[model samples]
Target: MATSELIYSVSELNREAKRLLASHFMTVRVEGEVSNFSAPSSGHWYFTLKDAQAQVRCAMFRGQQQRLGFRPGNGDRVIASAQVSLYEPRGDYQLVVEHLEQAGDGALRQAFEKLKTKLLNEGLFDESRKQPIPLIPRKIGVITSPSGAAIHDILTVLKRRFPVVPILIYPVAVQGESAKFEIQAALETANRRKDADVIILARGGGSLEDLWAFNEEIVARAIAGSHIPVISGIGHEVDFTIADFVADLRAPTPSAAAEHAVPNQAEWLGGFRFMENQLIEKLRRQLSQHRQRLNWLEKALQIQHPGERLQRNAQRLDELEQRLNKAMQLTLKQNQHRLTLGSQKLKQFQPIDKIAQHQQQLQYLQQRLQRAMDLKLVTLKRQQAGISQTLQAVSPLSTLERGYAIVQQHDTSKIVKAAADVALDTLIDTRLAKGRIVSQVKEIIRD
Candidate 1:
């Protein structure tokens, strides 16, 4: 079914095969015996790798051989880390090697890497997934060989740190193939018993094979699944295992793990003493505050007491009464002084004395008026006598005696000084000194 132009030549076929093999396969580890091993002066290694029934050509170039932990020779069992490919020039199937290690450790190293990558992918090695160790555990459980040095170190460290805390030991084999099962059962038993606040999975330093039991997947999973926090102190500081990676805390050694599990007694006692002093200080302040509040309340109650209020008001009333009496006395004294001044002014301008003086003056005026009247009467009498004597000298009565008569109108009693004074039809009186006569005129005559 192939096209003529699609056919591959010998060299082309080999090149095509190499490309296909390299693309289809990843880097792989092959464990077998080395045969026909040769190291050229060019620093290239060429060998044939075989098992009991199969063989394959292999090449470890100088670049890869630099990191080799051991020399590969004929009949030596080893592991080759290489790419599966065809040698293009020779048109042969071969392994292009990158590394070589002794098989004993090489297999375990491969298994360790495999399991490490698996648990890492599943997040068992994540810091966020790990639980925090308690500040002070009530009880500590240890899973290790009871007769081993690791248990002794753990117990000694724990006793020195905090001897009062109890310890529960689950004895197990930490080295053999059955060690993984024993450790896992101890973890489960500790959890079921619910007696430990924390558990320690510990072992002393050993070769990888000796430590293989701790690297089992069952033990790693047991640590990952524990409800209580676990501390793994497997091997020395330089040695690490799967249990260390999955545990909540990984200590360098068993003694260090024990140290991490508990707090010192003296330090805790010092902290408690400090707290007790603080509590006493707080109580004293509260008591002082309450006493001050009570005193304030007592004073307030006294201020509002009815008897106190009445007494204060009575004192105020007495003060006001005294002020009123003083004001009235001052007003009365001022009025008395004004009345006394008014009485003195009245005495200085009294009308009774004035009336008496006026009466005396009136009496004197009356006396003078009476004397004047008497003198006036006397003067008037003298004037009357003189007037009488003078009137007698000029009296017409003598002329009447000489026979002279005064003619007058008889009705009027008026003397007629001339004839013109008499009316013609009137009676006339002829007045002599002795008597008067009335005469009637018969005719008018102006003579």
Candidate 2:
């Protein structure tokens, strides 16, 4: 008996089995229901594919999972394309999934995708269509179940931030089949009331099937058609629905929606205080400027007296007259000295021979003196005439003499310059050329 000494390691046996399965079933398609499907944190998916007879373990890497349009979950029927391979370490046979597609419910997913794409193409998710949430909403309308935590959170936030703001709650179903119509009706009611500044549509987190009401087309359309800005806070941070896309604003959580709807009271109070201070400061500055202007006006009025101005002018005129008189006296004295000197020189030049000549010169000088005096008198008289004419032009007495009587109110110092100033049946003082008369005005006439 020549038995061949044959030995093989476990790894070699498993490797040979894997190579045979990969070559034989390189691309085999199997239809089964997904069970325990889980995409681990390592970016690798582990699940079991089961049929009526048996079950098989499966692994789909991240690279292959990326190709899948939708995530597969438990109870999902899928057609998986994979290769039969053996794990070399454990020597266990498993299917390495390369591709997967929903088997029975693929049509529904396709319809959802189609509708989403159509709405997206129609610009339903456009940022420009979004409305800005009011920073300080005066009134907030809540559309949710009356007993839900969402309403509690919103009310608490609103009361804490701004207690004065009024909140109007329109309780509506947030789950189940009838929730959609209730939500739509609530939105319409809020719009009809026109009381709410902004509307908040909120609910707590739930499963996709539980939250199907928010994804309904009618609810989405209602949110889109609402005149008031709608904030969709339907589910958890990871959950999204049609309402989220159609709403004017989407909040990740119910608490976040409450925070977004109103401002903090402390912050608003701080800002208001700052503005009040600024207004007060501006008023103070204006008042100070007006006070300084009043002071300047008072000083100017004190220096603008007509009597004081006249007194200063009189003093200046007197000084000028005194200087003029002194100049005239000095000129007269010089002329007299020159005359005496000339007489003395004539007498010395001819003792008694020049007596006739000296007399003729004296006569000529006297005639010149007389002519100068006449010219000065004539100049003085002309000056006096000009002064008289100027005085007459401005004199009230001169005006009265020209048939225009000056009338003064008997009780007031003001003169009745116009007929309109004195009414009929009033006492008045009339000044004529000779004297003044107190009389009552009977009938005043104006031309």
* Top of the candidates by lDDT: 1
Give stretches of model 2 more than 4 Å off.
1-48, 51-53, 57-99, 102-114, 132-138, 301-304, 314-447
lDDT of each: 0.85, 0.83
Per-residue alpha-carbon lDDT of candidate 2 for residues 32-58, written as tens digits (9 for 90 to 100): 989988876899999999999999989
Error of 2 at 203 (Å): 1.2
TM-scores of all predicted structures: 0.55, 0.56
**Residue-wise C-alpha lDDT for candidate 1, range 1-447, written one tens digit per residue:** 668659778999899899999999999999999999998899999999999899999998898877765687888789888999998888999999998877876668778988999999999999998999998888999999999999999999888878998999999999887899999999999888897999999989999999999889999999998999999998999999999999999999988988888887778889899999999999999999999999999999888764455556556656755675576567657756865675577578976756666557656865775576557556655655565555455556656877888888878888788878887778998888897787887776676
TM-score of 2: 0.56
Model 2 is weakest, by summed lDDT over 10 consecutive residues, at 305-314
Which pairs of residues clash in candidate 2, taking residues 3 or more apart in a chain or in different chains?
none
lDDT, candidate 1, equals 0.85
